[model samples]
Target: MQQTCVIGAALASCLAAGTALAQDDATLAAVEARGVLACGVNAGLAGFATVDSNGVWSGFEVEFCRALAAAILGDPALVDFHALPADGRYRELVSDDVDVIARGGAWSIGPDVRRGLDLAAVSYFDQTGFLLPVELGVSSPKELDGARICLVDDMATGPALDDYFHAAGIAWQPVAATGDSEARSLYLAGDCDAYARPAAELSAVRATFETPLAHVIVSDGSSRVPSGPVVREGDDSWANVVRWTFNALLAGEELGITSANVREMAATPSSNPEVNRLLGTEGEIGAMLGLPQDWAVDALAAGGNYGEIFERNIGENTPIGLARGLNALWAKGGLQYAAPFR
Candidate 1:
């Protein structure tokens, strides 16, 4: 069954500092009424989102939808995953076809206020990069001059490629594909000399190749594309729920909470006051959002923490093999820092 996005923040001043969450969370109400979360995710980005032959969904973004289901519905399996295409994703979100959009699109400017969508916490810190077959011998993107490149017809990627190529004074023919999977097919069939997109995406497709080592990815780290879930603008009450759910994942990692241990941790409050507050063993944090007191517990227990989700879905051990490079905790010097639970 299809539901619609009605939830839809910020840090400190942007969240309006001490503004009160709305007394009635319309989005949450709608979700509860439907009994499932309608999440729109990438249709073919392997590690970010994917579907098995049995039609079961699993991936980094899939876990996020599940975690949200656990938080609001008390069941991780209650979510309905909607595979969205790049061209029409925002239209689907805006039309209320999906409750929230969970994809690789950046929560960047222009997309936010212009589209009346509010971007949530950063789920993955990504950049625009390149993938070239080993036979191409193009160690750097600059090395490819007048190369035919397979480009995905997405919002950020084409402009990024155009700007980079123009700046480097190199001209290339583009082999356009509608989506990632199509682009991968174009690359494998030698339709283009290289393919360009987020490096993590390239790695995911590369891993599925018959000979993974036959390709090399070239990246200048020239773009900062931090991605997260998105919802319609103006629903502070529901927005806070999404914001804090992501925060719970990050804070759980910082506080040493895990899916295997979240129940145990919630069984008895630790001496740490923050953990107690986050886990609802000592505060009305959930009540403030008009949710059950065990909200964070269920969210954390659904898919462990941000780190755990990363490692399990797209981390170094997986075929996607994405490192925690810019996504590490703030304490450890990366950009991922959760706002205080207090």
Candidate 2:
């Protein structure tokens, strides 16, 4: 797909200042003209983002990029995926190389305030964790005193691991690895006693290990982390489009809506007002976000709702196989909640 740079009236209202692009009307216009949504993501992360054998990008993060494209262009396939190395992703987004970032970048004050980026919904509730082989017989991270731990250097994971271990008064040696794969190899080869990374990510890696079941995750709650998408700050139009694109997915799940049922629900009248409005059977919700009246319908149809995406991507059926502990809908005792679409 060719790159178009059109930011229309809908986008103009949403773009905010101090964001990466800061509402360059021309840039947005250029995007629209190109007719494709440019997306940036990590080079490779098993459950997050990766290219498959057929050269198709697939993962939870990639689903989001497609969702946004479907919402904006009325066609989900209108997305141009740019797989970027970890070090190059932030720069790519800031320079307008991609419309948004769906890779698993953490939301922090530094990126929001300094990088001119705006973070959207927390799609995945994650936590940092340590993986030690069963042979180590370590019951907890606290037992890792004087142990050599391998982790990516200078990333958020290092500081988080340090702070948690420091507060516990645990002294350990840091064996800095250049990237996530390197860190895992160092630990797996006995170069280090443990490997540290996001719990879901670490679990995914361990699944590919020789004695996968022998790997143990530290049970501390402090490691839980949240991950989400990002766009240039100051573009309220772009931000809202991405933010509610996520919320709509959550709301669809809450309302028992799915891609299969949305079309039918849209045709028939129902007592539920929120459902009516969300499906564009009653309210102009899409107009508020500068999308077609059936935008939400299309977004949901592009993939399943948030819950569906969860189950398919990292949920029990997939290799990552994360249970919906904190990611469940608010009604079912999870943190996933959406603002009223009225």
Candidate 3:
């Protein structure tokens, strides 16, 4: 009787382990069966992700989605873009409505690590600041005493700005708007003395305003914000899939490889083993991610490298006309660095 009981217990334990393994496989398979990756994006952030006249999506965030699609399904077009409002982003992601949220999310301990979500990678680094007329003569954000500042309702920016103002001993009027666009209009139309937003966003909006000389970004030393991708908590598999996609682009750029030149470089194998591994002349890294062996190639082919994507979307010739100040490749003295593929 004792021997029979021991055999039965061992059998049950083995069965439980098998069940857990099967459940994990089933979850991943279910996601793949959906055919398209649903990505949550900001409703309308110009340089980030926004729908256009013909209802086509384009922008920096859109490219990230496209790249993920290409890496996973070998088709860059296999993405369903969900333009979720800022207030709804968390709900949408937490409810399993989307696979990932590609919005311009800043990493914070409270919302990122503590709120049951994982931040993938910092794709675009930004700073928080205010845009006011040059006439305000406010060289520092601390000088905006009793000045009305426009901020979007239900966003972290308000609290952050308020904290800054409070600490600096400045009493600023808080004017809340329904959305960022509305807040921008309110400030640009002279409804408020200044408008506060992420620095990159301010640059994008400034390009659209007719009165370029009318606005100036208030330089506050405390607005440095890191923007990245996010996935649901405990989903390490999916998180790695998204994180390394951004890293791959940075890696490609640092290695002096571009989409235009990848094909030619692939043919004549490099003596550089690391380049060979990255170009997939030597490793099954993509297969390990449940993608084709040349997945990174497809990602680069869809866009270019990290530098190309930046230049095409927000660089000097683009409407945003942003200079690569802190975003330059590491070798070029910028902060963009990636782990070795090997």
| Number of the top TM-score candidate | 1
lDDT of each: 0.84, 0.79, 0.78
Clashing residue pairs, backbone N/CA/C < 3 A, model 1 = 4-99, 5-99
What lDDT is reached at residue 201 by model 3?
Answer: 76
TM-score of 2: 0.88
Clashes of each: 2, 30, 0
RMSD of each: 6.8, 6.1, 3.9
Model 3 stretches astray by more than 4 angstroms: 1-31
Tens digit per residue, CA lDDT, model 1, 1-342 = 232323232354434433434423668889999999999998867788889899889999999999999999999999999998865568788888888887647556777868888887778788877888788777788888888888877566777778888988989888888877788889888889988877777787787888998888888887767788888787777778888898999999999999999999999979999999999999999999878899999999999999999999999898888889899898888889889998
Residue lDDT tens for model 3, 1-342: 133324687888877766665643542454579888888887777677778899899888888888887877778888899887654466788888888888545566767756788788888777777888898788888888899988877666777887787888889898988877788779877999988877787887787788776778866658667777888776666777888888888888887789898778777789998778777788888777766778787887778788988888888888777788778877777777998787
The regions of model 1 sitting more than 4 angstroms off are: 1-24
Error of 1 at 31 (Å): 0.2
Q: After superposition, how far is residue 125 of candidate 1 from its true place, in Å?
A: 0.4
